[model samples]
Target: MANSLILSYLPRGSVVHKLTGTTKLIVFLLFSVATMVTYDTRVLVVFLVMSLAIFKISRVHYRDVKLILWMAFVFLLLNNLFVYLFKPEYGVEIYQSRTLLVQLIGPYTITAQQLFYHLNMTLKVVVVIPLALVFILCTDPSEFAASLASIGVSYRIGYAVALALRYIPDVQRDYHNINQAQQARGVDISGKDKLMDRLKGSANILLPLILGSLNRIEVISNAMELRGFGKNKRRTWYAKRPFATRDRVVLILGAVIAIGSLIFTFWDGSRYYNPFI
Candidate 1:
């Protein structure tokens, strides 16, 4: 079940994994801002390369992220389809030019500008996904909570965030176990089953999963209350890590990149790079 989970921190000794959670969080934030601040294709390509480089440094296997990558592509495809369906001339409006490449129907013509705009949109997602994966895969949930607390976030809120992240794998494991149990009782959710049958069988597992999750939540709440978990305004984190030289360097670099993107993006007086000009 751990193998099937979307995002659980991997215990790797890579350079990205060695950074403190605070550093990773801050750098990720900066990278995200930089990515969103520009529609410049060249800047996005740089960010996309940087994201891949960071992902490689993290030593997370493709198998670990294959499912998520597929999901992301599927989502990107659907999003692009919907965007074109609803607003066919969106790119023409943005780039202020429409060099028609093909005419599918009345309002569904394809243009170079539209393809270019969508290319930028695709690059944005491609750039951000890897960085997000690196941050989530490399940082421990407890350390992430500590990072939030170190940045002046409430410990209770930080702990809640940690719990949610930790629960993702737990919930997946529960679903797997429940699915297996039901299969033992002659239910078929395997590929051998019809699509509708598999879906119904899966739905059946949700009730028990929800009940089990609620029971676990109650047990955890009781234990926390007994230990006076929120009695004080501050709490110590055993996983808290201090910033090191590498962390400082990464943060400085990230800040520069973020600010540079903003400046470069607005320098031409528009976020969109008008090569059509």
Candidate 2:
């Protein structure tokens, strides 16, 4: 199960792959802030495009990105649904004009404003998702742990972060296998089954998955204890390497971008302040 999600972690030789995990993490947080500060569709679109360009340079495969794209699409669909339902007026107000796009059956009308709102939301995901994926996929887990320690996180905490990142793919694989096993047992999870029955079947799958995960966690904890995970006031890393000049440049660039974004937000008074009125 761990292997399945971890397989998506591409081993690459790009500059991004060589970057210290701590630096990458700081940059990722900054980019996330910049993304969240603006509601302007144009700004978000520009950032999203820039992010995609970085993804291309990082050399992560297209297939891996496809998963993120699918998730983003689902988010966009749900965002539009909610906006068009309860806050249709706010969506209509964003573009500062009422321009009808299409009218669906059952009294639902799509407007330009709603379209732009959904577009902006999608763009936000686009800008953040690639960087998030790149940081995880490119950095080795052990190296990341060491980098985290250098940044003042305890070694134990750093290890936990790596484990958590690895756990995501593990859980996804476990869920798939559990679903298949349930299906093999003549559990009807399809459209043919009643909605309540399907829900119950899914809940049943979760039981074993949760138990399995807890067991795995216990095993890891015991192994760490055996090795004196927290016994030493200092820990040594086999993969530890000093950050290079290039790394410093990257960190500086990230800081500049973050600071510049904040400055622009404050100066224009349009960062967190959405001037829809």
Candidate 3:
């Protein structure tokens, strides 16, 4: 999808990109679930390191994820801030200990336990995002759908996903073209305009973007119908590939990592590894 951070692919020859789409998808799922289930600082740190290493191996640059990273940073900061504001002592309750970090205004006091909790939350995000980005940016939409179908998902669902991913860039390109056309017609969407003016200028682009999107959807629907889509219970994929040894290795590794993370993190009968204990 056009400007999507985790649904658009960039064609590359990197090893990460060479992996089968299903394998990448498996890795993404396994790592994401593992990260979500564990609150162990050590586990999170290991995942963080592994994520960074994977990103490096994928040859992903800061520029590739620049906007996504900024958005995630803003979101995480706001989430942490609100958590502290509303439930600053939640960490203490969970960990069954309290160590004051600072005495803030009113009911808003900071504690090491809460900070650690927030740190783990942040680490969880860091550990999952790169995997998602890599899976999205490295996998081709058609190949992804084919891989999905190969994994026993219905071809109809797989085709729908492929189309959705493929259309994101189109929608984005349409938005940009419409914006530029409106700007040429004397709309002030440029940064030189005041913030409010720029915000309001979006009004000029919304109508055209929506109309363009609807028109594109109609065209795609017609084309799909003409091609006899969804007419059969089974379908063959043009982009499907037989799994390679590397694919098997990746899948096995992902499963092992996920299971290992779960076992180790919950070995003490708690979702969180309480360092204070």
Candidate 4:
């Protein structure tokens, strides 16, 4: 519940953090789509390296990147396990058609094609994950809401987005507190308790958490209504700031990269690069 996991609330002084939330959102979607559409491992590696460089420039800590890398490793292991177990024939086909990259057990083998496929998938995560983490870490909740509202999102929807982001950290903190309270009360959460009993105990914590959150939300809503929140057709933002020239440049550059990647990928006539083909 170290609220740090969900949203880093880190100081937003970097160039990337200065960009409007709406612009970041667009860039994120475009980059994700481009990464998913390509299967060339070399291209994906290049993209991943570029993304890492951006993370460095943005001043995101190495520790955060390391944590993400651990998660990525877990994801990679799971992916390989599933593929090898369910699609052993795929490995054989790839190795036979391409080149044997590695030979495992008596008959099991890893092929250049299989290696590249997994490498590309891993690199996609490398490119997308850091950008996503940076976005959440650097952007302020209030600024994000203002940006969303400026871009034609209704105030209610924008507020909802902000509230959801805010609630992530709150929920984590609440869960940790509840866990500690239960432990203090001598609830055997980690002992040799029956699985059903442990699950029921965990479920019991949710009731208080949900009720507490509801009470807080009601208070906020009442305050907003008293201040004539929705009565005005036009709402003003105290934290709103106009997007700067650099933000414009970043948005344009992001668009260019997205479009260029799409055009090049399609022109190659292979959504998934298969060297065997």
lDDT of 2 at 155: 92
- Once fitted onto the true fold, the runs of candidate 4 whose alpha carbons sit more than 4 angstroms away are 1-5, 62-73, 83-110, 150-154, 188-204, 221-236
Off by over 4 Å in 2: 1-8, 92-111, 168-211, 231-236, 272-277
Candidate 1 versus truth, CA RMSD in Å, comes to: 1.3
- Residue-level lDDT of model 3, residues 1-277, one tens digit each, is 3334334588768889889888888788889999999999999999999998888888777777788888889989999888888898999999999998799788888888998899998999988888888888888999999878877899889889888999877777788788778888899787798998888889879887888889989998999999999999998877877789988988898899889999999998998988887
Q: Give Cα distance to truth, residue 40, candidate 4, Å.
A: 2.5
* Whole-model lDDT, model 3: 0.86
Query: Could you tell which candidate, 3 or 4, scores higher by TM-score?
Result: 3
lDDT of candidate 1 over 55-108, digit per residue (tens): 998999898989999999999999999999998989999998889989997889
Sorted on TM-score, best first, the list reads: 1, 3, 4, 2
Q: Encode model 4's per-residue lDDT on 1-277: one tens digit a residue.
A: 3424546556748877777777776677778888888766666776787678777777778664466667777987898778776664473354356577777877567777777666666678778888887777777887778877877888878777787788777876887788789878877566589998888778878888898889988998899899887786668776677778887888799889878877766776665656665
Give stretches of model 1 more than 4 Å off: none
Best candidate (score: TM-score): 1
| Cα shift from native, residue 126, model 3 (Å) | 1.0
TM-score of 4: 0.77
Give me candidate 3's TM-score against the actual structure.
0.93
Error of 2 at 209 (Å): 4.4
**Candidate 1 vs candidate 4, TM-score winner:** 1
Give each model a TM-score.
0.96, 0.75, 0.93, 0.77
